[model samples]
Target: MTNINDNHVDDHSNIISRIGKCIKQWFIQDFDQNSGELDAAFKNNMLVVATLIVAVTFQTGINPPGGAWQDTKVEPGGHEAGKAILASLHLPYNLFLILNTLAFSMSTQIILMLVYNKKLYFEVVVATVSMVATYGMAVWSLSPDKDVKLRYVFMAALFPYVWRLSFQTFKTFFINYPTK
Candidate 1:
């Protein structure tokens, strides 16, 4: 009971499958060429990024752009302080606080993932987003001009997300090729 229509469908499916197989094979060969070196490189690279992210988050959260708040008030000559420093310009205090928290949280998670030996390829994505958000918060809070268009900053932020997705896709394509 062979339907002629089924043959056409199978033929099309076979072609698609072959194309996919070729792509998979290419990536595998590329990885094989490097043996386990790529995996080590990726891990090392991720470690570096995570470290930087943690540092950035820590610094931003602790010092912030405005500075830490001090209770001592100066009589028009001494500097006043609060939980955070006073900005020469308007400060998006609330926004920075939230972003700083998120960045720190994500950084902590990355460290946990490393310790647990678990990989969802989440390090780059979460870290990148956290870092970008922290940066945007800084730009938003510290910049004196509120009228400044943030389209460029927004676009720059998007790059990390895009790069993360692209990297994970490639890494997943190789899958368990190697890790040394």
Candidate 2:
């Protein structure tokens, strides 16, 4: 009984130590262990993630779910040409648009961050701006509802900025705030 109790305590201690080590490792920023340099692999992985997100969001924006209206109709209960059929659903469509835009914006931000220190940063910024513009155009053109179009465009264009600003404000106030 005594031996079993001792072994159990030792096992708990080992587990705790392992947990602590894992926490430390996770918190460590991506740096080459030997040279203390930023890991290229980390940057590459981030860039790939960002690019893929942009591509998916762009494709979804252009194609949308349920496709576009086949023909234009000015009558009541009819959809216009080049408008997303999903937009007619209201709530689900709005939710999808918001989430997709959020992903797109955050991914673009990541891309900017990764390339901010690069030599061709200006060119990359221009390309990202163009991509953003294209995405906005896609969203604006595909969404049919006149009332919803502005809202969708605004959300797609500005939600990421709002999100980043809100995040930074919260981080500054709550995270980096001095605790006396």
Q: Pick the candidate with the highest TM-score.
A: 2
**Candidate that scores best on lDDT:** 2
At residue 15, candidate 2 shows an lDDT of 95
lDDT (Cα, tens digit) per residue for candidate 2, span 99-172? 88878888898888788768999999999999888888888778764546466656665776776676556545
Model 1 ranges off by over 4 Å? 1-38, 71-82, 86-91, 117-180
Q: lDDT, candidate 1, residue 85?
A: 50
What is the Å distance of residue 16 in model 1 from its true position?
18
TM-score to true structure, per model: 0.38, 0.69
> Which ten residues in a row are the worst by lDDT in model 1?
82-91
Can you tell me which runs of candidate 2 are displaced by over 4 Å?
A: 1-38, 147-149, 163-180
Root-mean-square deviation of every model: 11.3, 6.4
